[model samples]
Target: MDLAFSPAEEAFRAEARAWLQANVPNPPLPSGDTKDGFALHLEWERQLFDARYAVVSWPEEFGGRNASLWEWLIFEEEYWLAGAPQRVTQNGIFLLAPTIFEFGTAEQQQRILAKMASGEEPWCQGWSEPNAGSDLAGISSTATRDDTNGGWRLNGQKTWTTRGAFCTHLFGLFRTDPEAERHNGMTYLLVDLRQSGITVRGVERLDGDEGFAEVFFDDAFVPDVNVLGEVNKGWGVAMATTGSERGLTLRSPGRFLATATKLIELAKSLPDTATPELKDRVTQAWIDAHAYRWQTFATVTKLVEGGHTGPESSMVKVFWSELDVRLHEIALELLGPHAELIDGEFAHWMKGYQFALSGPIYAGTNEIQRNVIAERVLGLPRK
Candidate 1:
């Protein structure tokens, strides 16, 4: 793939940069403790939506430019470089939107796509249950068809649902046939969080943020219209979504590069005498950050050339997750005795460190990614 951009592409890049310069927020919101930070992010997303810059990869009919993968990469690069505020609708725009585009009916698409694009609705994932974190097939949540009710009756508890506390909708996988094989019995459904028989309670993280929550459904009814794809085929749908999550959205190298840049800046401000070892670690973190960035560009090129990401995305996930942990570890090191601090000037780094600790765990754990690489990529026998 050509690394050089065509003249037309360069012109497009110039236009994007100009628009972003006029629109991108300066001193982007500190990843902080503000209760309204998420809402602030939502406002930023709406601004981008109005400008037709949000979800640049989505089809034009869905309020996107239907940009090429290269164009999408360029947009991401420029957006993050400009320090644009993070999108509050990322759960919708990044994860659910693609899934819906692939599996949803035309009517379902018409109903939800516009709302998501316009930031009129916020969506969250309901994939992880109390017993089904890493092993998604272990889901006990049931979404039984109610013949008389003309919809599926959902009754189950979903835990670790990110942004569930404030989200208006949820896309989840549930067992639709108990008697079928564990993975074969599931169905994916989109639920209205504000409807009757639904309850959401906050789950505080170690960082003291209620960024995730437990959601309960007590015979909640989801209309057949909300069912995504065919019933009892949710496992495949979920696999596809998870692949995208672990491979694309969550592992975007541009996001990690921006994060690493912040860490480097923080490291430079720390006292040199604090710890020589800390400096070395910080340098290594910078190198890893750049490595991830170039790898991401390569991945995007392959995708643009109509090649599947395959197991290489698993490698990306592993690299970024581990690098994230290392970068935060260096940050904590630079904090010295103040490492324990969770508020004030260091609060942002502290929260980031906490989030980075979870990087290896979410969107498929590092161990699982290793298993994927060994079995699928290396052709090794499963243990």
Candidate 2:
């Protein structure tokens, strides 16, 4: 694949860079997990929507410019370089909307994707449950079709829901047929967060924040049209989204490039304290970030040529997540004893360290990802 950007991509990059330099939050918005922060980010999303920067790869009817994949990557690079606020609508824009576009009905796409892009209705993922985390096939949540109501009655609990605290909607998986075996008899269901009989309880994590929550569905009612794909085949639909999450779509290489840039500056600040070994490690981190960037470009090239992302997504996920953990570790090492502090100048890296550590566990654990690579990518026996 050609590493150099085309003339058009270069022009797009220049446009995005200028816009971001002018529009990024001055003081920066608060964490979107908090109530006040959510409002701030919501308005910021609306601004991006108005500018058609929310999802450039989407069609104009869906509030995007119908930009090419390369343009989207260029936009991401500019976005991170500008240090813009994190996206609060990622669950909808990145994760759910892809599957929605692939499997949703015309009415569903018309109603959902536009609102999601405009931040009029933000969404959260409701995939994991008390019984199912990495092994999503073990999920016990059930969605039964209601003959009387002409819809589905959802009754189950989902845990570790990102953005659960404030999202207005959720797209999730539920067992539509208990008699069927694992990975079978499930349905992808969409439920309104404000609907009755649904309970959302936040869970505090190492970050001392309520970024994740547990959502309980006590006979929650969902309209029949809310189903994304066919009943008893939700596993396929859900995997498509999960593959996107584990691949370059969710965690763009731009983020790692930005982190690497910060690490380089930090290393310069610690010239006297930086040992030869530490310097080498920092350089390696920078290389790893570039490697991911190249890998993403290559993968996108193949995808544009009509190839699909498969178990290779797991490999990408494992590499980047572990690289994130290592990058943060190096930052802490640079900060020395001050790394433990959660306030002042050190708070930034400390917060990043906490978040990086969780990256390996979310989407799918590294252990699970490795197995997928071994069996699917390497053609090894699953047993």
Candidate 3:
């Protein structure tokens, strides 16, 4: 397959590269997950928004350049190659925004997309609960109808929400029909975290970042207008967001490629540590990164040709998550004892390795993904 970009696409890549080179923080911003870092990252996000690079794939009316999927891929490649700051609004732009465009009403689109693009109202995913981590069908959060109040009353809790404590809004599924079980009778809700009956408590991660949170709702009120898609038929809507989460948008190949490039440099810097076995691992990881990039291009081709991702997204989730773990593991090995240092040049590898360890666990664990690929994609018998 020809991987060459068109002339127009190359021009777009140059433009994105130039902007990112000029705008990405020189000293690099802190992890956007932390409080002080979140504030700083918001400023960077606004800079991207002002430059019309925040959501390149989105429509111009919604603060984007109306770029195509190929251009979006080009922009991602440029964005990561320049070592830009992590996107603080990723949960919304990468995961939830596609769902909103596909499932949201005209008013919902206008009201939410612009602010989301500008980082005025960042969003966090609210899919996991204490009882419903990978088994999302077991979600127990309830959204009782309040016809007189013209909204729904939400109750229950969401745990392990990325940036939950810092986000202004949440998009999640709730059990709307008491009699409906499992995947049935759920409603996707757009909730404000600052409401009176809601509570958000930050959870400190292994790296000492308060990146995750537990959000609780006790009769939290969300208006009827906030219900995304048809009420009590949210399973389909939620799946759309999950597909984006697990598939193309969330973990773009550019991220892995960038890390792979860094891994190569780290290996070159430590000649003594580069054993044959380690060398093989580094070569294989680099090859895997390239393979992933090509795979993503193929997927983009299919998508551009009017194809939609279904359970095939599970294959993507498994490949990229494992690739991330492998790439970071090699980096730490290259660092040797220096990996233990929490400051200076080696710190990022340690921090990245720690975060990479969670990749297989989140995004519906590799085990579950394999099962989905088996049953849904390959048509294997479940029993």
Candidate 4:
């Protein structure tokens, strides 16, 4: 149960902290979700890549430092503490990369990971559809075999894809068998978004950023080489990605801890507005962030001891997403009327609050996560 970092770990932390302090943009770059801002973010991504910090825990052969998982956690804490730009390439690094490592061939690994680390080709998730938001098994997108073309022909649409309009690639699940229903007969496809028969339309989010997109496919062809894992066993493969999305990888405690620290500072600056209830909430949020941090460390330790992420990730998802909302809510409350400002000093709080609102809805809704916990973690009956 000990949580102390070893001398080596502490030295690693110091090294990461120094580099980030020296490199992170002083004024901060614009949101990576916007077109112009995305360009700026790409520049920042390249800076990190050049420093070998883009994918620290990845293999050395694939544009990474080959750091241990504990070091990875330490790096995340330092990255957020430095107020680094949003990782425009996160969908690939955090979610899809692990799946590729687990299910991809050597050729696929060589083809994908380096470009991803360098931000030469960014990736987005194509999970939710117009009809299949939470129940991903209900997606109607299809990828039929095209033996003549030596590929699969995709024909359907994916909606609410984060940064879909800006990304160069996509990783998603598609029904490969016409007769099969639900999660069966699906295939995981790595698609080039620039290819023919594909359309990406940006969707404006509550924060006024075009962070979400709807992607359409009509007779889009993907070479057989782009397929990850087995053709019709995509459900399992995709679950691995989703497990990361909902688990420790995607929404790390570092993010919440950073916000909580900001929240406390904001509260301190507004002593007059800090009523007892508001003060208590701020304290609670800070404590929750620390609790989550230690909890995540315990999980990481378990993983080091050969355990795996699973349904318990659902619990982690629900807690962190809700914690995010609460932290931002308190920030907005502290800002008072200034929270309504969309420009200047108070703008980030409002923007963060809006983004926080979507946390429960994406990465499978909190409601859906609770069901996963019930059925898989608690072993409850489906009824």
Candidate 5:
């Protein structure tokens, strides 16, 4: 298979590259964690929305350019190349919205997707509990019917809610049936962050940024309509969300490839230290990233042919996450004492390492992903 873009695809690439060159912020924008930074990111999202660049692969009626998956990949490559600020609404746009698009009602689509596209309401994922991280089926968060309120009364704490503090809504799994055990009697509910009896406390990461939070729900109310799919069958429906996470929703290979390029640039700056071992590692990072990019193409092709992807997403997850950490590790090694700086051109030297280390932990830990590959993909017997 020749891995080259068609002429039309190349034309599309030109359009995307020009648009990104014209639009991406110079000196980059601030982190979305701060209030002012968030506002700017939100406006930036709106700017992309107005240009139909925010979600290019979605249907045109839902504020997209209606581009094909290949075109979407092209746009992403250009976007990352431009060093654009990360999408402020990624949790909603990537993780939650696909589930809604696949399993939600028409009314739900009209109400939610429109707002999401406009960046009027950002969303957060609420999957992990203090007790349940990788084994998401073990979450004890409860949501019982409230007849008087015509909704569910949610009560329980959800920990490690990524970007929870900046978001206006959260989508999480709640055990709707106390009697059913392990993946049974669960429901996926979308909760408004501003609701009463709910508290969100930010967790400062190793980089000293409050990017994660723990959300406490004390009889918080969510109308029945906010629940996705059948109350007790949410476990099955949630695969759509998780599948999106691992497949292509949360990231494309472009970001990793860009980082790999940055790594090479940094290595060039340290020519004295770019030994054979270091050179080999940098090349390996590039190869891994390219492998991921190709694998994504195969996955996309499978989807286009109406084929479903399953445990293999776990493989991609492990590969890319490890690749990320490895890339950052070598970057710091090249930086030497410059990596110790908390502010400067080398500021992210440490921050990137910390962030990349968390890669294996979140979005389902790499250990769990290995099990998924062994059992589901290879049909290995469980121990």
Candidate 6:
């Protein structure tokens, strides 16, 4: 199949490129790791929102340009090519907004999507509990209906919640019907963090950044309207959310391309003592980066053609997560003695390696992705 954009797509690309060139800034290189740089990145996101460039794929009614998926890919490609800062509203716009648009009621969409798109309501995913990391079906957070009141009462804890400390809202899955099967008994709930019954405590990462948090719900009240999708059909909603997480949100080839370019630049500036292995590693990183770019092109084309991502998005997830780990590993190797350095560019690489360590863990672990490839793609027998 030819992987070329049409004339209309080319024009869209040109428009996006011009807009990015005119508005985006090339700031000082990111300091520390992901968490340390989150706030600054968020500011950059607000700037994009103000310019109407944040969510390019959503319908125009929800603050996006209603561009086709192909145009979305082209816009993202152009944005990264211009060295623009990453958007902090990514989790909100990419993951949550799409779910809301597809599965949420019209009123729900009206209440949530605009704030999310405009960066007025930052959101965090509340899927993984301490007891249920990869096995999301094991989540035991309870959301019982309060007979005396006209809402549900949430009571449980969520861990490894990214941006939990600062997020205004949380989208989570809770056990709504204890008698039903594990997956069937659940419901998706939107928790307003500003409410009285919720508590958020920071969890410092290996890199000493407090980006993730543990959130507690002590009888937190959520109106019936806050329930996402159906009350007991949250498993399907979560599955779709996971698909979006894997397909669209987490693995942006444009973001990785920008990162790969930075890695190449850093490698070039290293000492002559750089080992042959390190050089080879850098070369392989570039190749993998390019592979992911082409894969994204194919994926976006499929989306434009009204085809779902199927198991291929899982393949993309595996590719990018492993590439990310390998890239950071090579960076750490290149840093050599400075690998342990806690400041400057060396520190940034160290912090990135620490965060990259989680790639396999989040959005369903790499092991899970492999299983998906086996069972869904290869038609392997489930043991």
Off by over 4 Å in 4: 244-250
Residues 331-351, model 6: lDDT tens digits? 888878888887764676787
Every model's Cα RMSD, please?
2.4, 1.6, 1.5, 1.5, 1.7, 2.5
Can you give the lDDT of residue 169 in candidate 1? 93
* Model 6 weakest lDDT span, ten residues long: 27-36
Measure candidate 2: CA RMSD: 1.6
Per-prediction TM-score: 0.92, 0.97, 0.97, 0.97, 0.96, 0.92
Per-residue CA lDDT of model 2 for 1-383, tens digit only, reads 35698898899899999988899998778778777888899999999999999999898999888888778888998899788998999988988888987889999999999999889999999989998998889999999879898889989899999879889899999999979978999999999989787999988777877888999999999989898999899999887766553232557888899989999999999997688999999999999999999998888887777777778888899999999988999999999988999978668798889989998999889999999999999999987
Model 3 agreement with the true structure over 160-277: per-residue lDDT tens digits: 9999989999999999999999989999999999889999999998778999999999999999999999999999997766655223364678899999998998899899998989
296-317: candidate 5 lDDT, tens digit per residue: 8988877766777778888888
Q: lDDT for every model?
A: 0.81, 0.88, 0.89, 0.89, 0.86, 0.80
Q: How many clashes does each candidate structure show, in the order listed?
A: 0, 0, 0, 0, 0, 0
TM-score of 1: 0.92
Question: Between which residue pairs do clashes occur in model 3?
Answer: none
lDDT of 4 by residue, 266-300 (tens): 99999999999999999999999998998888778
Local lDDT at 328 for model 4: 91
